[model samples]
Target: MKTKDKIMIFFLTIITFGTIWIYWNSKKKNNKKNELSRSEKISFDINDLILFLGDINNIQNVENTHKKVKIYIKDSNLVKTEEIQKLKGISSTLVSSEYVNIIVGNVAEFLKEELSRKMEK
Candidate 1:
């Protein structure tokens, strides 16, 4: 009704809208980050990893830790270390003597199980 009351209401409305917009924008950005991370996880390919580990036949033993996959190969020279490090979900690669340890994020357990099964058959 009064001019002062109208001006106050307008400023309050703008502040409320601004707060809502900032909150919504932050939430949207977080969702997008989550989606990108999920996509990265899904991009992991066990077949490619196995191939880079010098194939199933070359592998002497496969072990999985919480966040790493330790693969013991008959001949470490047969492994393609560079290629294995480039695969999705692979954080890093470590080579020691006859074993190669791969940091495969959360998929290490799954990879170990798959490799074990392949070795059996």
Candidate 2:
């Protein structure tokens, strides 16, 4: 082939590969964004309870109480009785003191609820 023709072919090949790479990268970024959104939803769902745990940092313990699971936070003193009562209405029960223990019977319940909402669309 002529030098000019070979050079043109090479440039075209490079452009094609570059376009494919860009498209793939964009798709990956979108997937990551979707995953991040889902993660944020889960985090937001538990944010209030986490904050109510008080100044103490970190989750101390988690226990299964029958079908319910209890999460004990390091500092429970920050939790208010009214807030605990509201939480109990949402799930099985919520107990808070110097350390907070929240009982959620089914962790998957939130995910299931979210999934069903999505499926409705």
Top-scoring candidate (TM-score): 1
lDDT of 1 by residue, 1-121 (tens): 9999999999999999999999999988877644312112435677887788778898888897777889998888888989988887778999877899988776677778878998999
User: Pick by lDDT: which candidate is best?
Assistant: 1
Model 1 spans > 4 angstroms off: 1-42
Global Cα RMSD, each model: 5.8, 13.5
Tens-place lDDT per residue, model 2, 30-91, is 77644212211333245455454442244554444333445555555555546644653245
**Whole-model alpha-carbon lDDT for candidate 2:** 0.51
**Against the correct fold, how does model 2 do in TM-score?**
0.37
Model 1 residue 96 CA deviation in Å: 1.8
* Global local distance difference test of model 1: 0.81
Clashing pairs in 2: 76-98
